[model samples]
Target: MLKQKAGTRSPDLTVVEMRRALAQRIKLLAEKPGEHPTAIPGLSLYHRTTPTPCFRASYEPGLSIFVQGRKRILLGGTEYLCDDSSFLLSSIDVPAQSQILEASEKTPLLSIFLRLDLPTVREVLSRDDIPESPPSTHRQGLVAGETTVGLIGAVMRMLELLDTPEDIPFLGALAHREILYRILRTPQAERLRAIATSGDLGQRTARAISWLRENYAKPLHMEDLASTARMGVSTLHHQFRALTAMSPLQYQKQLRLQTARQRMLMDGLDATTAAYEVGYESVSQFSREYSRFFGLPPIRDVKALKNSNTALVSVA
Candidate 1:
């Protein structure tokens, strides 16, 4: 929840109106109670009828705007809550746990997700007219901010494309760029600027993260990761933790565990085989860590997950 001080101003009424309008539009488009793709590339719409139990997933860089109800996302120990008044943005790919906190049959959770185009972000930064924001290691890659009329308007136009699919090829890209421009003008601009700028801490950390993602099944070396990121080991450790909220090894562990779970659930691999495929040397060690991370051993967890018939609407 947003804090309200004695003299603090209340939210603007225009934002409330925009939120309602977006919610109504989504309700019309998303007749089913789950995530659905729109005509525009990299855009997804979501609707949910009830509060949900927490579920874990990896989210790539994107902006999630909730229109009707509230949702909470947990990244490491950080909590990001989004509702009609606010939006959440992830500037880098990050593993997170999320839950729907407020929704009902009459007023379900409605949301739109716009995947960030890093190339376009870099192109926007390259324009000489745009002001340069100084880079900082303290910048967090995941954040939530109050919605603006301009941002909401851009999203509204993007969603409007669903009504006229013929104009999507020519107009959708322009509308997406406009949305990125609006976000680049916000206070979080520097955080994103750092991610796209070459040689910056954000870029360096991003490279390291990419490497870990691709080679998660292989044994990791701290020095090798630092070298790949073009930073000293100490600097890499500090900046990586500041951006991602975890050490390099911890990040790899999460990737491995998540992948192993996916293999078992999706491919029907046995627990021991899945563990080995994900680089676990010992089955006992794999079971212990898996249990610690997922709250159950592999077999039992997979069974429970398969038995549950609930459908979760999420954005990545």
Candidate 2:
């Protein structure tokens, strides 16, 4: 049997070896930009040679693990930091920024992100000795836990598939499955596991979230959304906030404003048109909400995005 770790007993026998191998994998993947789709899709990984000061921005739901550095995330006015021994898990969609606290010119900030997918989590979770974590109120935008060796090992194997295209369609799936499985068995795997199997208020809230993203610009009705989530309107309202740290309407508003901002920046759409396209009945309302969420009016924000060159760029 694999020796149990000091604080946590990870079931995988090769946890330590796996972490060392994963260190190498992160180094290799960091060699080039866009080299890690097998691990994280839709993110443009950046290498930082300098330690960054505190900052905050919206963090999408995902796993962010650094191989050579440490960082901190600021959310709801709280700061959380993690190093090589730790990994960050963002369960729900959040708008927060993170700062790199540790980096070196020689080592830089080496990291890899695996964008979490709900459907994928569901599939892998159905297969193992996974246990349900007791539900909690007031979900966190982010949490940190000691990185398990098995999790690291699974990540390394997933990256290895990049060198061989033939292994992807078949072996790649298993690698992906194993990665999730390892996460299920980790110390704080409960948060992610909750994401996969909870049929409670949180899960219902997540379903309502899917509706918001899929139809951001549509006219939103609480009753309709509740029905879609298979919950009553009052229950939906309470549960959505309990899970996402924001109200349902607020959630929809964020989705609309972000997409509208993107349209203006990328497609060069005029502010009025962008507002209408993203489902604002009145341009005035769009401008008001856009400024509230993004800290700038549509035209100025678009200009800023263009000037920055890195502003609101798409994963593509």
Which of the numbered candidates is closest to the native, going by highest TM-score? Answer: 1
lDDT of 1 by residue, 1-316 (tens): 3221111237688877887898899889998888888879999998888887898767788888878888888776677777777777788878878888899888898888889888888887888978766544336578777778898999999998888999999999899888878877776677778888877878999999999999999999999999999999999999888888899999999999989988888889999999999999999999999999989999998888888743322562
Model 2 alpha-carbon drift over 4 Å, by segment:
1-21, 33-61, 75-80, 98-105, 117-120, 131-138, 313-316
Inter-residue clash pairs, candidate 1: none
CA-lDDT, candidates in order: 0.82, 0.67
**TM-score computed on alpha carbons, candidate 1:** 0.93
**Candidate 1 colliding pairs, count:** 0
lDDT (10s digit) by residue, model 2, range 5-85? 124334454655665566666666566533344433433344556665443255666777655666776555456666655
Angstrom error at residue 278, model 1 = 1.4
> Model 2: what TM-score?
0.79
